[model samples]
Target: MASSRFSAALLLLVPALLAANRPLYAQTVTAGPDSSAVAANPVADSLRRTEKLFGWRVTRPKKAALLALVLPGAGQIYNRQYWKLPLVYGGLGATGYGLYHYQSRYKEYIKGRDLYLAANGRTPINQLPGAGDQVKKETSVDNIQRGIVFYRRNRDTFIAYNALLYGVTILDALVAAHLRDFDISDDLSLRLEPALLPTATTAPTAGLALSLHLK
Candidate 1:
């Protein structure tokens, strides 16, 4: 009888102790709704940033554009516009060569501009041993520096043109791929035909008429 009473008293005391400690323990707990939202915000922001950089793009034109930006002719190849590859390569090669050529000339002019002029010198280009005949007309210290500026500007221009061509290649691929599925059969066309009509106050007589119809 004494053991049974001790067991019943232990069970009652355990619940009373837990009830008294519940408030204090709950104060230390951080699994509440506000805390959970705050914790999840960082993960949400990380995923959002990742999505901004590498979101899904499954379209052919989009893929072609990206491929063209990385590789010039690859997009055209993807679009089955193999003939455009030659034009792309040709424009790039020509602009690249022009940029190189102008850069070399600009460097040479810079060197010429830095040379000290002698009192007896007639012209700057004539004073230099290996100067080209092109600068002989404007052969002065100031003129040589000006030529340097001109050639440098030309080099920069060619570089810009080259970049423009690269961007055009990408745009061409995008447009071509986008229009690949467009209808181009004989059923879709314009036909011109002769037509005659009477005006409000005039009769139709030898009037040149035109009509356009498409299916």
Candidate 2:
């Protein structure tokens, strides 16, 4: 009985195998992507051009940092970050103006003190360059001295602050350039939820956790 069943199964399989092996109509039915559609796409063409343009590339971060170190705001310009240029220049310019203004005030105080001394039997006052009529008011010696101390301290403080600003500009350029390609896009998402999870103590526990998913 088993031999008879085996023969019947072979008979059923043989015709199916023969049918599978047999070829159908010879008409060609090739299926593939349409090359013309890709070629005709404007967005694809633009992307191809961009790829070709960047083929001859140099290191961007290094170049940006170098430009910034050499000249304040130059790095931002190289990175095509135009908005930062004003801030860099504004900081440096304000510092320069402050140094000039405080120095001028210090000179005025000195001239006033010297003029008062000259009028009271001391040596004649030595005129400072571009010293205006600010000393003509004849303020007291103590007031002139106090002005000198105040302006000098302010001037020194601003000088140090300016130096720090210069360093900060270079650092900003370096870090900004390094992170220029960092993705801060709308694809970023965060989620928080309460859930129960099994812990090492073999008991289910409720916990709070944060999750971030970036697309």
Candidate 3:
């Protein structure tokens, strides 16, 4: 008899538990975002923010500038000005080569000058610092000093050239992005037409009329 009572109580409790959970499930479903609302604003839903450098949005002038700053030719690529890439890289490459060449020569001459000065301008040609051939070609203390000055000047000039070229590339990318949508077609034109001009006198004078047409 006690077992029969326990079974009856269990059946009653199970129904009560299921009934309580049903309301909680209904509330959860109701609190969820409405599918209809999401579908209604398709454009707003479709738009999404992307990761960009320095908090700048991609495909903008600032983005182009930032990319150019980070990478040598990145800005031109971003701005779709592929033609300028060759010019930018070529100028940079030439300047870099020149800088290296001049710097190396400057160091060679500097070593030669130090050797000459240490021996009171009487350093032997065989003891000078440089290639065997270069030492033979210019062994005088005066000549070594002149070479040092010349090579240093050229090295500094190439450094400036590299800096200027890098700045130009970045600026070009920014300007190009800003002017991407500008209209420069022949359809937008200015023309001169003959027309009658009203003058202070009673008679009207004929003159050429200049007009601008923007298509």
lDDT of 3 by residue, 52-140 (tens): 76664454667777889889889899878899889879868977898898898888777766766777756586665543455446857
RMSD of each: 32.0, 28.4, 30.1
Total colliding residue pairs, candidate 2: 0
Residue 64, candidate 1: Cα error in Å is: 1.3
lDDT of 2 by residue, 62-83 (tens): 5666677788888788777889
Clash tally, candidates in order? 0, 0, 0
lDDT at residue 160 of model 1 (Cα atoms): 73
Give the winner by lDDT: 1 or 3: 3
Judging by lDDT, tell me the better candidate of 1 and 2.
Answer: 1
Ranking by TM-score: 3, 2, 1
TM-score of each: 0.56, 0.59, 0.64
Which candidate, 1 or 2, would have the higher TM-score against the true structure?
A: 2
Each model's lDDT comes to: 0.64, 0.61, 0.67
The residue pairs in collision within model 1 are none
